[model samples]
Target chain A: MARTRLTPEREHELYTAVLDLLGEVGYEALTMDAVAARTRSSKATLYRQWGSKAELVVRALRNDKPVHLAEIDTGTLRGDFLAVLGRSDDCRMEKNSALLRGLSHAVHDNPDLFQALRELLIEPEMTGLQLLLERAVERGEVRPDNPALSYVPHMMIGAFAARELIDERPVDRAFLLDYAESVVFPALGV
Target chain B: MARTRLTPEREHELYTAVLDLLGEVGYEALTMDAVAARTRSSKATLYRQWGSKAELVVRALRNDKPVHLAEIDTGTLRGDFLAVLGRSDDCRMEKNSALLRGLSHAVHDNPDLFQALRELLIEPEMTGLQLLLERAVERGEVRPDNPALSYVPHMMIGAFAARELIDERPVDRAFLLDYAESVVFPALGV
Candidate 1:
């Protein structure tokens, strides 16, 4: 007999479980069975809901951002960037094992992973930063043609991944934000 | 029976093969067996020479500094940064699939990949830039206490990588240099 299909609530529950696994295992070691077992859902339900581990993880990441990236309200460009890029936040630093491992491993093996990573991980952050920079440009705080303007957000965040994955550091938010204000913003002339 | 160790002439042949493979197959897909076949050395010899992929790759990157980076002689700091970065001659921004994959993958697993990448990639260019900045400081073109001096390398190069990896475009060196001059140097109170 077929088991009753997983409801939206149940799927979200599993997604929460997936996030937990992502934190625990990193992407390389995260497996379908593990996610299923942890969530108390069958592998069949997981596959039916999200198709594969990558899809499930991407789904979870998609769900994670609205909760993680809190709204920032600092008035100055430096203040706003600092608020958004708080070094105390896990998402801001390179220490989110799941996000990095997922991006690194997923890009190599699955186009879906790459697309999803770009959409979920890269896009939201880029768009958020563009909005920030646009605001700064309007306030006349930053140059309209600042080249680092186009690239700094991505660079600041990506450097964390590069540092942890390559430099073997913990990728803490303090270190990242300090580096950003000291290096990135100054380079942007703001 | 033991086979004779590879001669220095044979070792050089093998190192060249690794470079070609690094630019061709990437770090993850490369293997000792494949390298042996490329170099016409037996797998035993390859294993005997290097224990892991990380070690082998580090050796390859450390082999020698090419004329490309050392040749930049632009009269100004901004010109020098532009000349070395985003230029086609050095393949710095080329984003060779094999090379990036290798670097990205190897760095994730090995502790030493960071040092190798720094020494092989980031440090050479940064060291040169540091010298240029020092000269500028002596000439009173820039301040000795400029905060931008501490981390511009990461800002510029990290910006380029972020543009390539996330934005999915070829990094614009001209933009980077312009950013340095218009935004970065000026903010340094130069």
Candidate 2:
């Protein structure tokens, strides 16, 4: 029998279910059977669509992102960063943080998932951030020779990863905004 | 049977074995049985000593750190930072980073593990770092009101967490020294 094609809406629903399950049980414990039950879809269809659990989870995470960094341009680096933070509300950011935390362990153990994350999630975000930095340089806001330029992604990502571990606080817009004003912007000497 | 006490050397051997197993199988797949067999100890003794796998893993990780930041003081913050980096060679840093990445995910799902990590590993590190920063402030090297002071640990830790994720690089002394000079020092205006 030919596999039924899913509508875009149906795909979104499936992804949402996957993310919900991922958040609840984590990547290690999340199962295709559970995902199928949650989404009311057959396990075969999911496997057919995503190839494996790693692919499916990565795709679901990729789809969950509402804004692409490439699409953000506010003429100033600070403005652009603020715009990026504004893309997700506090609740959504918290949920995404939990999801990412859940996947962090899985990525280390599973090479396929790490590859998928790099290709689908990390690469796009890096490209978008690079574009933003280039534009800032073109605008003479950031020095092209700044040593800190290469470390920007690391700094931003570290902020997200270390927040809960360091301060026992969630990564919220206020913290990010403050980080930008104090730590990041000064490092860039902007 | 009364639990036989392990000598300090034997305890060190056991912790080393636990860390090895953790690196091999990760936190979720790691079993007390595997640890006991690997260390030539009984499961009952393992349980009695550590109370649980979470506690055992956390203790092993804590024991792995050779340096405490509080003991690092070179009169200059930059010198102090460099001294801290010098504590771990590249190979040890790489192993530690891998262990940390593996544990990052486990900490999220297991509250008991998280609590153990906080009480044993994180709190001491944070306190040591705080002492360093306070000394810097006292020396007038950093302004007392600098907002960046509080975020120093976040930035340093973020660099460690983000290195592999962003650049596929290990957190080494060279990278950290460069990071301290370019990103961290400048942010503090020192």
In terms of docking quality, model 2 is: medium
TM-score of each: 0.75, 0.86
Measured over all alpha carbons after superposition, the RMSD of each candidate to the real structure, in angstroms, is 4.9, 3.3
Candidate 1 wrongly placed segments (more than 4 Å): A1-13, A43-52, A65-70, A85-99, A158-168, B1-15, B28-56, B62-65, B68-75, B82-98, B110-129, B172-190
Candidate 1: C-alpha lDDT = 0.66
User: What are the interface RMSDs of all the models?
Assistant: 3.3, 1.3
Error of 1 at B45 (Å): 8.2
Which pairs clash inside model 2? Answer: A158-B158
Give the candidate number with the greatest DockQ: 2
DockQ of all candidate complexes: 0.39, 0.66
Q: How well is candidate 2 docked (DockQ)?
A: 0.66
Q: Which lDDT tens digits does candidate 2 get at residues B1-190?
A: 8767889899999999999999898898999999999999999999999999999998888788878887898998989887877777999889988887777777757889988988988898889999999999999999999889888877888788788778788888888989988899999989
Listed per model, the TM-scores of chain A against the true chain A are: 0.73, 0.93
